[model samples]
Target chain A: MREIILSFPKQFKIGFKAAKGIKVLGNFKKLLICGMGGSALPGEVLKIWLKEKEIKLPVEIHRNYSLPFNVDKKTLTIIISYSGNTEETLSAFKKARREKLKLVAITSGGNLLKICKRSKVPLVVVPKSYPPRLALGFLFSSLMKVLTNSKIIRGISREILSLESKIKLKKLEKEGKNLAKKLKQKILLIYAPEKICVLAKIWKINFNETSKVPSFYNCFPELNHNEIVGFESFGKNFHTILFIDKSQNPKILKREILTAKILKEKAVESSFVFLKGKGVLPKIFSNVILGNWVSYYLALEHKKDPLEEKLIAEFKKKMKV
Target chain B: MREIILSFPKQFKIGFKAAKGIKVLGNFKKLLICGMGGSALPGEVLKIWLKEKEIKLPVEIHRNYSLPFNVDKKTLTIIISYSGNTEETLSAFKKARREKLKLVAITSGGNLLKICKRSKVPLVVVPKSYPPRLALGFLFSSLMKVLTNSKIIRGISREILSLESKIKLKKLEKEGKNLAKKLKQKILLIYAPEKICVLAKIWKINFNETSKVPSFYNCFPELNHNEIVGFESFGKNFHTILFIDKSQNPKILKREILTAKILKEKAVESSFVFLKGKGVLPKIFSNVILGNWVSYYLALEHKKDPLEEKLIAEFKKKMKV
Candidate 1:
């Protein structure tokens, strides 16, 4: 886990070259990302990142078996399975092929990799040492390369290379430890602006997997409409972390502040983290790295192994039978 | 609350004609439904419904300020604000207009309605008598009408009309009350198959609003990959309600059963509600109606007012300032 966190910046460089030999076919009307768990998260992050950059094409993430009903010749489907063996993703990849949709695959060396190779589908191969959840940097950067190659996004490699020196891990760890202290015994309610709301979800997943804690996330503007009402009954068992990106729409920013204030009045502890980084890529990565540290520190505080997922292993084992 | 629940079937009929005078323009490349809370829930339900029927165009739901970056001339943007005054929906409406996207509005007479009127946008006005959450029938049916008229979907109105006679509310209420007894004094983790997952979300909202409970939802196949792991640490405080649709992907149905079994091994109580309806529309509505009764009965058992949303009202009041 520590190695994955420390090597995040390096993964960007590795990911940049991982897809060098693959050529992207442009003119797809939509992009469908198929994966589950950690593999699926980067797609969501990319969706918001693309939205923040004002990209015009719709990006959809499908976490289940089969491609969306809308998958067609005009759709580009990317199948991601870090271990290369996730059943749902394999199902989706085969369905995408049967439907003859343009396809890409990202994996280490599981069945997904073998199938892609046999089918002559484009593939991006990353190293397989780390757990899928900790390999966000490689997954996200590879996806960025695909988008860049397809001409859907431009000049991300420069931003990604700059991120190596820009992110300060030690400082993030200190901040994470401080925040973990406050969040130790509390149920977490993470809130973020809509553009970067995926970060909140990432945080929830990190907390769930790493710290073995129950957490939930919601985005502002939307949460303001309904979930804000929910905080009234939650009491002191909840602590909210608001991910505030200054670049978000001013109205949403105001709502975030007001929401924190309301949470305080309702006696629910709350804190705000202004998103770091000048560009969307950096901002998203910065928040993700910070969340990783937070969840790790939370695990340490709880005396739990950050890498353990016994129940998940058992569930998968049971499914195999 | 009782009036709204008992008249849900009638609301579907009322919603069928809610947009009679409005003409839908065809040939849109994408459908973007913009709303929040109850207004937004229908769009999610519609997305799944369209998927079930194999509609080829992508349908996306936008719950925050402004439309998705993909909104264009070929995108059909529906703005729904039951009260016509929701700030986020209003913001999206203006943004859609500025972008010159095709527009439609569904609302009671509020600021959204007036603006749509002045802007000459096609509008669908449902009755203003019920709380927005309770007005799902009207919103969903009106949306179905718009989709049918635009040729994005076919034959939904007939299914919705048939729902009136097919759905037995009294029986649903009894089932709901029985489930509510089990769910009382427990945190809820509602699970559903991906196709009808919106019902899980509707149940969460109903529980939060009516019973003042903290509830969360995730769909099958996806949950099997991650959230099922979190259940190990969730303790006995959490009770899970699995909404099982018989027609879901066979693998997903197996995962749902296995997930319930795993939860039992973890000592987390769970119960399954097999969806009753034949088609996606009827099935979704059946679960939603039953969820409504469950939440209502939960409120009654807890001696709480099901209709009250004091924190939300207060939050809105503060936002206006």
Candidate 2:
């Protein structure tokens, strides 16, 4: 039996309260989130849930080590570091404070907390104890609360609650009823736009680390330009192409639909999963729950034991550098 | 033995001669090439080569469907489609021409030819036979001839001869002799300014198509800020990390070395690939030659014929709607 590692989720009340407690910070021009991996998933959820919301400022995620050189004081940066010690987030926190941009931070503890204390930036302390990846729901909901309170987005609370409940509808993936399990022998290609892309990325990472499967995620509109043509060669050996389609610009949306359809006809097997939701948080959460459950099922499907990551652990131990 | 589809390149002189006879215009403020896999490699080669050139016009290769929205009349757009049918390139070409930007075309034949002919723009045609992947030397040399004629850069004759010799070096790449073969299961994280990132991207595409590996190319100091930290978690599942290190600024150079060392410590496996050349054409061609040889060798290592592409053929036959 594979050792599965996951805590029975705490009463979803913590996330619910945090999501309900978001407050508006007046005068921020753009909502910028500087985060990586699990911490960043929340921003993606918010963006996707709020796709229809008239976003006044472009919300950009800084996944690299530094912020774009052109950032100005008008930017509202939310620095996310699970350990609070994440180096890149710390670098960005210092830079944001140096420029005196408005700031917020999410973490249990680390240099982020220290810097936020020194700089007097607002802090939202998440519950510590679990891996950062598992903390995605809380982080994502909190970020959504902030966006909604700031009026950059409206109506996300119900979506979060809705997603929390709907996840049960996907059969609570115990053992045999898992879609992700089927993906074990195949490469997982998660395709989506800005918000969904983050969820997809998180899902890919989860599959890689937990299941030890090589998976990938990419954004749309961009993929159509180069990667679409690439599939002309992927053939039957290529198992699946999953498109997490949400609402997008009419023309670009059509391009995606047409391309996915063309690829399906061209390839041995492909899947087009169109998803919809009331708010960004809910919609992103919707995909997150599906991916999470499916990957768990996939873990069981491959009989790889859902819990062990011997390769990653061994690599880390050997490298101590 | 597996069935052979695409064969090892046999005759190359005609391709080389055709490449030697093209011309590029020189009045624009910036050079932007609309390119996909085949000729895109040349764009990257030129970026590296130009760093050492006597006179250099800043060049950008738009790899996606949309030209950077910042593009305008001062941009000299070169649309490159080896088969002359890439949709993204065509889209950008249409937009560039519609905006009245000066345009040039490199293609064998397709709508690109008609668009250029009817619009009175110049077109340089190559013989359409070999895989676009194998035809990089011809395309790079041809583009160089154009740039040289248009007075964008100097030292073309020498560059072509160098490219020719380099292509010869890539033939029948065998085990220990093929550098590219060793890079399988590695990442080509290229770091350059947006202008030069084109070169790095070409290296990545070559690895993906020719070598069948996962590779990445990104520009810096943007990378300095973000992606560098990913090494901490990358620990060791990877085989290597190759930086298409070019001779550039002293500050950027120092940062790159430090970044590589940090990544090396963090990576499971890694190495640095330095690019050497005296002008735009030579450097670009050199990298391509090295990459091509490496990939060919890698294909051989897998005990599979390098030229067979059964999947892509099937994709063409089955894709519909």
Candidate 3:
């Protein structure tokens, strides 16, 4: 797990290389990303990134067994599965094929890879070793390369390489440990602005899978409209971590600050973590890397194996399709 | 609150009348509904209803302030705010207007109505009095009528009217009271199939607002991929409500049953609420109405007023925008 965390930058380079030779099919009206669990997280992050970049093309993230009704020939459907064996993604891939939508596959080698090979769909294969959740860098970079190559968005290869060189993992680890101590034995309620909402989700999933804790997230403005009210009855059982980006709309930032005040009044402990980075991708990945360290420290505090997903294995065993 | 619950059916009739005379602009390439909180719930319900009826036009629900970048003149944007004063909806309405997207407004009366009136946009005015959360019937019916009148979807006026006549609120209240008794003092984790995921979200929000509880929801297939694993460390602190419909895909149904079995093994108490009704709308409404009663009863158990949203009021006062 530690190696994977440190190797994130390297994964991006490898992902870019793997994405090479894959033909760009431009003029697509829409893009659909199909995956579930960790595999789906990258697509979600990319969706937000695209929105922030002001990319005009519509992108839909599908986590279900069937594709959306409107997915047609003009739609570019990207199927992602770290193990290439996720039932839901395979099901969606089959449906996408039947619909004859333009298809691409990202996997480390499983049934999905075979299907892509047999069907002549372009494939980007990442090296397999880590759990799917730990492979975000590879999965996300591959998807980003596909989007850039297709002219759906501009390339960020140079920026990614620079970010890799600039990131200081030791510093992140120290900060994560400090925060994890404060968050120990408390449920986490993560909040972020709309543009970085996926980052909050990543934090929640990290805590859920790594620390084996029940953590949840809600985005700003939207939460201000509804979930903020529910905090009135909250007690000390939860601690909120607000991921604040300097670029957030002033109104949204005010809402987040006021929301923290409200939660404090309700006796819920909360703190703000200002995200640092210039570009959207840098800011998102910076927080993503820091979240990994926080969850890792949390796992240490809980005395649990950060890499083990026994329950997930049990679930897959029971799942027939 | 009791009056509001019983008046659900009557609201549909009034809403249908209110929606009349609102001209529907046809030939829209896509549909976008912009609203937040209660107002947004109806759009979500309508999206599912449209999917079940196989309406091919792509419908996207936007809860944020800015319009999607893809919203061109051919996109039909429906801005709904029950009070017509929700800041986010107003923000989105202004953006949609500037983009010259086909615009429609549904509201009782507030800034949104004024904007629509000044802009010469068609408006559907439902009656005022109840809180927006309690105004789902009116909002949903209004949106449904717009789709029907626009030739985007077939009219369900007769089916809705029949449902209004056949619904037995007294029986639903009794059932809701029984369920609420079991659910009191416990956190709720609502689950439903992909087709009815929005219903699960509604239940969570209803619990959050009315019962003053910290409730959350996830849909099948998706939950099976990640969250189902989180249940392994589950204690007796939470209860799961699986909203099951017989008409759901067989594979999804099996996953739901297995999920329930796994939860039971983990000592997480769960019960299946088999959705009753032949049509999608009827089944969804049945669960929605029942959820209202359940939350109301739960509020009574918590010694709180279901209608009093002092915290939300405080939030609005603090929100500058």
Candidate topping TM-score: 1
Pick by TM-score: 1 or 3, better one: 1
Question: In candidate 3, what are the lDDT values of residues A157-235, reduced to their tens digit?
Answer: 7765566766667777788889999887776889998778888888888888888777778887888766765654445
Clashing pairs in 3: none
Each candidate structure's TM-score, on Cα atoms with residue i matched to residue i, is: 0.95, 0.63, 0.95
From the highest lDDT down, the ranking of the candidates is 1, 3, 2
- Cα displacement (Å) at residue A78, model 2: 2.7
lDDT for model 3: 0.82
**Whole-model lDDT per candidate:** 0.83, 0.58, 0.82
What are the per-residue Cα lDDT tens digits for candidate 3 across B196-311?
88888888889988888888888888777667655444446678999888877888888888888877876778878888666777788888899999999999998989998888
Per-residue error at A264 for model 2, in Å?
Answer: 12
Q: Alpha-carbon error at B102 in model 2, in Å? A: 11
- In model 3, where do residues sit more than 4 Å from their true spots? A24-27, A149-154, A231-234, B24-26, B98-101, B118-120, B231-234
Off by over 4 Å in 1: A24-27, A150-152, A231-234, B98-100, B150-154, B231-234
Candidate order, DockQ descending:
1, 3, 2
On residues A1-49, what C-alpha lDDT tens digit does candidate 1 reach at each position? 7777878778888877897766567688778999999999889888877
As for candidate 1, its clashing pairs are none
Best by lDDT: 1
- For residues A90-126, what per-residue lDDT tens digits would candidate 2 score against the true structure? 7777878777777778777877878777766777777
